[model samples]
Target: MRPKLQIACDHNDLAAALEDIKNVGDVVDIIEAGTILMLQEGRQVVECFRALYPEKIIVADTKCADAGTTVARNCATAGADYMTCICSATIPTMKAANAEIDEIQVELYGDWTYEQAQQWLDAGISQAIYHQSRDALLAGETWGEKDLTKVKKLVEMGFRVSVTGGLNTETLALFEGVDVYTFIAGRAITKAENPKQAAMDFQAEIKRIWG
Candidate 1:
């Protein structure tokens, strides 16, 4: 299956998110109410995205560390199709969050083992996000063999994996044959002078490689 494009509306400004979405929403497959946005504007940001794009997939990047059920319920009630939890959270916490939404994505950031991942899958969770942390990116990191190795292993383990952090057209080519369920872009599209064209460029590249 072809990979999907997801826009990360991670900035703190709702209006800015809306502006970028207005220009690129029709092309992207998912709209993420990013962590910063969720923090700054609350789930109201997710609600606002839903109000405008009723048919679109919205992810609340809540990174829930505790109170899983309540946080997941709140996000789902606010119109999130998916919510995220940090990988280090207890299995019970992740399972509790998974119970309230369509799906709960395990955000892979720090350290976690395949054993823990198996626990998540056994608990009815299926999605995982492999990220190159923003701080790491800022400190000069890029996706490479180590990332691909883990991503492939995750796919083989029945995970619908999403790769995020510093993704762009050039970086995307690195995963040409990998079955990434979604490729998340933040400033790559939102900060572009022409958001729509930026989205189109991503779609064009995705189709070129995945088709």
Candidate 2:
């Protein structure tokens, strides 16, 4: 099966987000109202996206560190199909989030180990997002063998994995052999000259590698 394409709208502007969605919505399986967008707009962003395109998967990238249940319920009511929580969250937080929605996705920053991942999987958190830090990338690092290695290990640990962090046309090819549940592209798609064609390009490559 082809890896799902996720478009990340990381900015605060709703008009820009809607424009990108209008152009690329057909090829996108998941639309992530990114952390910035969520914080700035709250449920309004999620509700707006849900109302406009009911068929697409809407993810609330809350990156919840605590008070998981409250956050999860709010996002769900706002029309999120999935919600994100950081792995550093306490067991109670994780469980609370999972209770509200079956599809809680744990975002893995550099701090988490495989043992912690197992605990999350045991808690019924079935999805994992291997996120590359924007700060690190800005400091001049690049995604390479370590990303592939970690992604494969996360899969072995029993979490459906997704990856993000400055992914674009050229860099995305690096993960070809690794199985990913979803590929998240923020500026690469949303900032493109032609958003729909950009999405199609990513989808084409994803199908070639993972289909």
Candidate 3:
């Protein structure tokens, strides 16, 4: 199946994010209210995007560390289709957030062990994110075979994995073995000069590879 594309707007200004959305929202399947955007503009950004594009999938990238329930509920109430929590959060917190939201996405940011992922699967949370390490990105690394192997393992475990961090057309090919339910791109699309054209190009590449 073709992987769904999620556009990440990590900008600090709501107006700038809206401008980005206006350019590429129609082509993208999901819109991620990224951590920086949420931190800078708060849940209002999620609400505004939801209000503007009710048909689009809006993911609140709260990256919830603590108070998962409250954060999840707030995002859900504000019209987020999906809410995220850190893998480091307690099982109780995960359960609480999952209970309150329609869709809860857990981030595997160096916190979730294979055992922990299994436990989460047992608890009925099927959506998980496999985030590339920031250190690796800063070092100019690409998605290596090891990354694909991990993602394949997660897919075998029945989790719908979301691949994120420094994704672009050049690296997208590396995800072939991985059943990526969602591919989140931030600067690749949002920072481009022609955001709409950038989105179209990415979508075409996705179709070329996965179709």
Candidate 4:
């Protein structure tokens, strides 16, 4: 399957996020209601987006920690096809969330190890995210061969992984060895002068590489 392209609208303003949707919604496969947006506007934003584009797959990036079941339920009820929780969230929480929804995504961020990723997979969680820190990006460190190796290892272990953080055309090449299930592009698409064009370009590149 071609890797999915998720467009992250991490803005605080609803109008700006809607504008972004209007621009790129047609090309992007997933619409991510980023953590910041969910924190600011709650389920209303997800509902609005669902109302606007009933056919689009909406991902609510809740980043849930403790109340994973409730968060997942709310997002799913609000028409989110997928919702996210922190990988470090308790196993009970992960299990509870999974029981409530069919397509909840758990992100492994901030010190989660590969062992933990395996545990999540063993617990029946299918989707995961790996991100480079902003500090790492600002320090001019590239996502090295080691990162791709990690992704390959995770894929070999039967987990679908999404690569995120500071993704752009130049950095995207580093993903060659990584069987990335999805590429999460936030500021690269939302902050572009032409958001729609940027989304189209990213989608085109992904099709070229993964299709």
Candidate 5:
């Protein structure tokens, strides 16, 4: 399938986050109420974004490792179409969270393996996220061959996969021949001088490669 773009609004200030969205919202496929933003502004931010762009997919990146049901309910009530749960969370928590929302994305990172993904897929979950480790990115890392292998393997297992962590224009080319259900861009677009143009360019690149 063709890849989709999810622009992460990582700011703590709602005004700033909305401003970022205002600049690029029209051109993107999904809006992420980033973990920081959600922590500061709460689910109301999700509600706010939903009120503004009812047509776009809104994701509350709660990254819930526990209390999944509560987190999922709040996100759903505030209008998030998808919520991410850490794969390490208990099966009951994963199930409860999935029960409360339209979709659940099991976030896979940090020693998370294909065997773990098999368990998740077997549990009836259909989506998972592949994030480059934050510490690795801070150390100047980028997606590599191992990342590609995971995306390919996960798709083969019937799970839609999203990739994130330090993804930018230069690195995006790295995934050219792969099947990515979604490509998440945070600082790459949000911090750009002209976010709208940045987003338009991102959309263009995805279409250019996939079409």
Candidate 6:
């Protein structure tokens, strides 16, 4: 299957996010209400997007470390298809969130072992997001062999993996044969001069590689 294109609306305000979504929302398969935007605008932002694009897959990047069930419930109540929880959270917490929502993504940041990932699978959580992080990007880091190794391992372990952080059309070719469930681009799409065309370019690249 073709890798799903996700636009991470990591803006500080609603208007800016909406402006980009207005152009590119129709093209992208998933719309992520980024952590910063959710932090500033709350779950209402998720609801707002849900109202605007009811058919789109809406992800609330809650990055919840705790209060699993509650956060998951809130995100679901707001019409999000998925919510994110940190991989460092306890299995019970992960399971709790998983129970409340249709799907919960284990955000693979900080220190997490494959054993822990296995545990997540055991707990009925299948989605894993391999993030490079904003800090890592600002530090001049880029995706390399190390990142692909981990992503490949997770896919081998029976987890559907989604990759994010500073991704672009050029970088999408790197994972040509890998089964990445989704490719998440935040600033690359939202910050573009022509968001819709940028999204189309991404889709065209995805089709060229995945098809």
Residues 65-165, candidate 3: write the lDDT tens digits.
78878988899998998988888988888888888888888898864588999988887789999888667789887677888888999999999999988
**Per-model TM values vs. the true structure:** 0.98, 0.96, 0.95, 0.94, 0.96, 0.99
Q: Which of the two, 2 or 3, has more TM-score? A: 2
lDDT of 4 by residue, 1-211 (tens): 7778898888897888998889888888888998888888888889988898898899998888887778888988988988888877987888888887667687866677778877788888888887786678898866777778877888888878888888986677677656789999988987889888898889888877777
**Global lDDT scores for all candidate models:** 0.94, 0.87, 0.87, 0.83, 0.88, 0.94
Rank all candidate structures by their lDDT, best first, as comma-separated numbers.
Answer: 6, 1, 5, 3, 2, 4
- Please say which candidate is ahead in lDDT: 1 or 4: 1
Q: Is candidate 1 or candidate 4 better by TM-score?
A: 1
- Residue pairs that clash (backbone atoms under 3 angstroms), model 6: none
Superposition TM-score, candidate 6 onto the true structure: 0.99
lDDT of 6 by residue, 1-211 (tens): 7899999998999998998899999999999999999999998899999999999999999998999999999999999999999988999899999999999999999899999999999999999999999899899999999999999999999999999999999999899899999999988887788889999999999999999
* Per-residue accuracy of model 2 over 8-118 as CA lDDT, tens digit each: 888877777787788887788999998998788778999999998899999999999999889999988999999999889987898998888648999988688888888
Window of ten residues with lowest summed lDDT in model 3: 170-179
Which pairs of residues collide in model 1?
none
Task: Give the C-alpha miss distance for residue 128 in model 5, angstroms.
Answer: 1.0
- Compared with the true structure, the alpha-carbon lDDT of candidate 1 equals 0.94
Clashes of 4: 0
**Which scores greater on lDDT, model 3 or model 6?**
6
Q: Worst lDDT window (10 residues) for model 1? A: 11-20
User: Any runs in candidate 4 off by more than 4 Å, and if so which?
Assistant: none
Q: Candidate 2: TM-score?
A: 0.96
Worst 10 residues of 5 by lDDT: 109-118
Give the total clashing residue pairs for model 1.
0
Those runs of model 5 whose alpha carbons end farther than 4 Å from true positions after fitting are none
